[model samples]
Target chain A: MMQEPQQAREAFRGGLRVPTSGCCPGWTQANLISLPREFAYDFLLFAQRNPKSCPVLDVTEPGETSASIFAGDLRTDLPAYTVYDHGEPIGQRTDVTDLWRDDLVSFLIGCSFTFEAALLDAAVPVRHLETGSNVPMFRTDRECRPAGGLAGPMVVSMRPIPAERVADAVRVTSRYPAVHGAPVHIGAPESLGITDLRSPDFGDPVRVEHGEVPIFWACGVTPQAAVMRSRPPFAIAHSPGHMAITDARDSDFLVP
Target chain B: MMQEPQQAREAFRGGLRVPTSGCCPGWTQANLISLPREFAYDFLLFAQRNPKSCPVLDVTEPGETSASIFAGDLRTDLPAYTVYDHGEPIGQRTDVTDLWRDDLVSFLIGCSFTFEAALLDAAVPVRHLETGSNVPMFRTDRECRPAGGLAGPMVVSMRPIPAERVADAVRVTSRYPAVHGAPVHIGAPESLGITDLRSPDFGDPVRVEHGEVPIFWACGVTPQAAVMRSRPPFAIAHSPGHMAITDARDSDFLVP
Candidate 1:
């Protein structure tokens, strides 16, 4: 039932601060955002324009608490939830059971973790999992198209792929367009405006061996950056690493 | 080069009344909605949920005038315009050159005429086009989930598919997701809540042969119906027959 995260979120609602990954297997997860209805068009437009970084999965009808088109229950599906108001974290809730509103619309975006499983399946080393650290993600100078007030630079997650398996990395991951698709930048960190592999704007750093080079894929965090820049009167997003679990599988998103 | 609609809109703005379709081919076109930002989330969720009816090709950032994303000068993109305020058509304008607003968000939706062209390429006969009449459409009993406050039934366009060639008919049309990919209700009209094929809620009726079955596909009119049911304070949709032609080629939307 993928109940660990659900239980954790239940506890988180009571108060828990922890990243939830590998906690739910086979249950597809999502990046969460709840904002006033006024921002829906711009946010959806922004996500459409910048799909690699923000592949929208399902958008809940405004005022509708449950994602009727996607699944039956969103409140109990995720392990926990984080609330943001006026562009700042208010607090974490296991269930948004209390904060639900009729004027708010929720957006579920595809996450990079979907493809990470594919990488591991293809025999690609996911150092973050092996070393117990989050995948290194860097902020790039590449400017995403500014939609309305939502505007910001792109953010990318990096994984060190062995030189010999680099082509395999692209071939394997390209099959999954719903989860960031293929690499936006590979081999050179500086090309993507990254100065060093040791330091990442978000997430913990992982090792890059002499034979391995950093490969970057667009991250779900990009639109969150845009939301932050716009500083809407109210906005919400998933906590850095916590995500909403869903029923979708890796094969569901494969482009081919 | 695409100045006919511009001239027509100019005439309408200067004061003219006429329908717009085939006025300009090599031009980008769209359904115009000028609503308060509050309805943004529901409308977006509605469109996302009902893509075949509201297959969004482009959505402008919030509180903006021209559809900078897909349409450059919506001022003269089409030959005529309909301004609706609270589910009622206000007046006809050739060019909404003066009606632009920062609070208005424009959306470009895929028109089925594109698929008719594709069908023509495959030698499929388009009955409505042959008879110089609109394709027959009916209101189905199936209800679309209310996004925000927008809620209504699904509307479908019906075509008489020769029983022998139903497979070919499905194959030829299913490729274009942009133009309402595939038929939703293949044979039975009653099953879709449509009782009669000779009379339709919208569009002109056509004859069905002895061996032909009435096939139903989701119609673009579904959005207009949803808009009408919701009765937003203000909205603008493409006039029933007039469609916005896009820069995209039909082949691009063809599914393998």
Candidate 2:
């Protein structure tokens, strides 16, 4: 069995530079967002206001690459990094050691992977995971509360749950509030301004079989969407589906 | 019955300068902290790390007094304000409008009052509340995980719960993680370095009856303790027990 910290250490040594999905079972996986010191507070406040979309797991002080909560190095532990310049992707690299700066701050945000684990444990079928494709993500018409220079539409990931099991899906996911808990929308995609479920703005669309209702949960990609719209001078984020596996158990975040 | 926002507006009009306990029956109350732009990031990081002590409810951008989640003018809506200089409280004020600066960032943190309500609802007796005295707060040997320039001993408030009902108290309070959540210490104050159950570092002490266990929870005063220890050039906070009444319901913060 692969140990959690060992996996991160392997990634740090450049041996594991692939997506972190399915690594460190029962622990949380987090999305990474890095920005300059000047924009750090704004992004933090944005996450606070839009908690459903951006549940912050941990934050690093400016010039600090170590995450105290997750207990890992930000610069090298993750398998991949994507750097953006003025809202546009400049490049992707295996390690961000060359781009590290004293003015930079990083955030570890909760990913939907934890909730998917809960759904599966509760016997709620997760379509994308079953089909071996990326979960479909869409930009919603709902406007997120703006914070300083960051603002955009709420982004959601959809899963088609059997109509009889939607309540179970909601109940199981609601226990993990730190990982984008509960369904934000159910049974209606057009209300969120999604024109077609077959063609999503991100990820692959899965089958919405008969007797199933499409349920959407707030997505961690919401921050990336906000950053792309706001276009700070410099920013770094984990590539899509590449997350930082944390040592914290999914049960650790569950509320009574 | 006085409405929640109306009560806050009364304080804004300079007519209500009393503790906010029992003022808004169902709404959440928040502790206020205002710091300069330079120290804002550090305090935010500090709160993010010690969540049980400082669960952030809302944060304002630099120079902004309005909180979107809690909703109010940070300058005058609170019943009282305390100004600290280099970690020393020099004065108390009804309004900080004249002292407001372009670089100040305000943070609203979760108050223990929310979870106390939960305890009461669960048929658990809150000793201090029953005695109509301020909750007994003590500084512990436990060091908060330091963030940037902020670090200090974790401060906790003690409650005397009957041994038979301690589990019920924990189960009820754990539902509100935005508040202090569950007890950090139970039955033994000595383990937390408290020698006298009748003496506390802050607030009034209450009696521990026979068959009752002294339960401890991380307190909001923890940030004040850290701020005092750090000694920043300037800081502003709500006077203890005088909180900002929020529009959010205590139920809104409850988890499954």
Candidate 3:
């Protein structure tokens, strides 16, 4: 068990490969997305326009490996990375040092894991955690505001909470706006054009028990969906569920 | 008096040049800084690093005439614009339609005016508004975190609040973090390297009453200071005290 974010990053840097979900319990985890400098401005605009789905934590200068939030070398620090060629996944690798480019710009986006922790702390049960499965994510029919060449449906991560605890969940997560914040939709997945709750486009679907409501929050995977739909020349992202554990604590993002 | 933000923008678009202070009272005002595309990423990163000094409200795509938050044409909507050539102010114009370039990227940053209104609403006396003087702004000794070719000292706006209402002023302003937020310093002009209360680097000085304490909040003018020091080849900004009245309501920025 990694006790600190730096320890987790150091282990990853030394060639250890593992998902970062439970590591460094109180620290914040970030979603990674790197793109060529040419595509950076448009993507930044996309994140700015759809802030709920793509709450940015840190953005590096073109080709810079380290951001203020994460001091490790980005090329080798993450547990795993998925490389995309014109929106198609070309390969997944534990280290991307060989593929590093000076013109590539990296964005560190806030992850729902931070808010999930808050939800759990508030006594709102997280279904996926109990079942030991990935949180289910779906592509909604709603279109995000287009920016330059990027456009796609908003992707949302869903969790099952007791109907009575819905308000508590919203209150807990609302304090972490840097992370997805509050639920985008509750109860009716069909309203978002999600035909079936058991079959998600990304991540594993968890069981929805009796009296539990399906609540969805804007997912950080949103930018990846945009990348796939828009087909940027090249891009890279952390494998779903695998994240960069940052030095910042979950409380660092909590608003008063 | 313009009753709506659009009306104020229309008046400016029609060449009515005047400071935007007190216009569209319930609307949010923004500080404009249009830079060539070459400087966009660095400036964006600079804003990310120094969020308090430069809270980005909206960023337009290269050469975009308007943003979602401000539906008016950027080239002619603002009351006045100061064009800069290698850091020096070349001219102030009512319209920049002729100088508008395809690669110019505009950043609409949060202005202190929004929180000032909040402060006034909370019954926290604002000295500048009472005296009909521009808020005094000073370049502080503290340097903002530099980002890729942009480096300069932080600039702060000073307000004199009654010593008893300082806590109320802080609470009211803190609710609107998007607009410079709470006071960065309270009751100490000399602490920020501001030599004298009467002599400010920018804007007009106001009298601090016997029972009033001078409070300082991060100012939007910090970016202009960076442009001056970094010497970017070209830039455009709102002339001092003249702002771009945005369509977003002041309430839209209030958190919690």
Candidate 4:
């Protein structure tokens, strides 16, 4: 039986710590990041300027744990979290209830997992999912638009698709603008200053078959990258692949 | 001869005060609203929650007078501005330079003027444009999703389209989601709590011809309505239809 988003969140709240890739199949999964109130404005402005890389799903008011999209307690609902201090990952925890502060502002960002399902449903192969590996992510030469004190290079995830299915993948994913939308780069990674396909900056490299071409889409990890570089005094983010499964249906973000 | 966005701003900077309709025809015009840094987060969140009512085009840093979308000095560029003290209109000015402050954050919201051109291009008759009157806008009974310190009813602008051409209007305007996309209600004004079409809360009402139906789209004046109701300590907005001409072209916002 497929677990509902609430059930999955309950399990996590009860201390189930694991990656959330295939959990709650039809529901939307989101990347979670919390920053102190002092830095929330700069980060929000940064997301506004670089929308493709940082498609915001929902934002919470200061000290609030839940948003309209995710009704569970944000401090304990996710499988795993990384606590950051001045840009360095200080530690990982299953829950951060004790460390949560009154001035913390949480942001839920759209994740590509929503569109990967769309791609597969449209018969476009998602290599990473088939191989049971994390998608390949790379830091590119392109700099994101700077806002206030936050700035960083854009990070993108790559998927290998048959040349014939590239257009179909673009069409299917374009409908979900809330989740990174269409390919940022269709082919030739070097144009974006990506030197080697085998060595990605983050995640596992997947097999690119003979007829397959590498396609890139803006990654949700971008805000984390910015946090890592900008080094704000305090921040919290979901562990790389462990996301928060929200109550929103996949079709909610789809546009006609 | 047509004026470029820069040229239009130059004229406004030189004290040309008038409604911006039909000015810089192909360029996009945006509604301007500036508030103190204290209220910026709540308003940005309000916009995020109610995207249909507030399609953000660009937002400037506190004290910053320009954005990438609008390159001219915001303090002196727009034709006219309305200053508010605790939400009550205090005065109107051609240039806000004397009143500008470093902690003031400005938001550029998408205007229906962009999609109105698209409607005209699709051969949909725009009654207000034809009759040389302002577009009719009303405060709907429906409430917008509230954010901290900001809450109000949704506001909509009405245009009467020939019954047969209503579908075409929706298709054309839906492509420009940055501006208010598609009509919220079609045919009946009373359904939206608007008792009469002759008198509107804002703008001059136009005659609805026979065989035509009234269509309502989310209006750019919404943020102003929110400001009026929320009663922020200080606020500045474009004098109704007197907007800031942006460098972005209408086609820039059209999605496939």
- Whose DockQ is greatest here? 2
Cα lDDT tens digits, model 1, B138-211, are 88999986666889898887888778777777887776666776788788777787778899987689899898
Clashes of each: 9, 0, 0, 0
- CAPRI band for model 1: acceptable
Rank the candidate models, highest DockQ first: 2, 4, 3, 1
**Alpha-carbon lDDT, every model:** 0.70, 0.83, 0.87, 0.87
Q: Across residues B1-256, which tens digit of lDDT does each residue of candidate 3 receive?
A: 6779888888998999876666778899999999998898788878877888898899988889898799998889999988889999898899999988999999999998877767777888887777777788999999999988999999998988888999998888877778888778998788889899899888899898899999999999899999989999999888766788899999988766
Q: How many backbone clashes does candidate 3 have?
A: 0
TM-score of 2: 0.92
- Among residues 3 or more apart in sequence or in different chains, the pairs in candidate 1 whose N, CA or C atoms overlap within 3 Å are A5-A79, A9-A79, A9-A80, A13-A94, A28-A246, B9-B94, B12-B94, B63-B102, B64-B102
lDDT of 2 at A119: 80
Give the 10-residue window scoring lowest on summed lDDT in candidate 3 chain B: B17-26
- Candidate 2 lDDT tens digits, A103-209: 89888898887777778778889888787677788999999999888998899989999999999998998888898998899988999999899988767888999
Question: Second chain only: TM-score per model?
Answer: 0.82, 0.93, 0.96, 0.96
> What TM-score does each prediction get for chain A alone?
0.87, 0.92, 0.95, 0.95
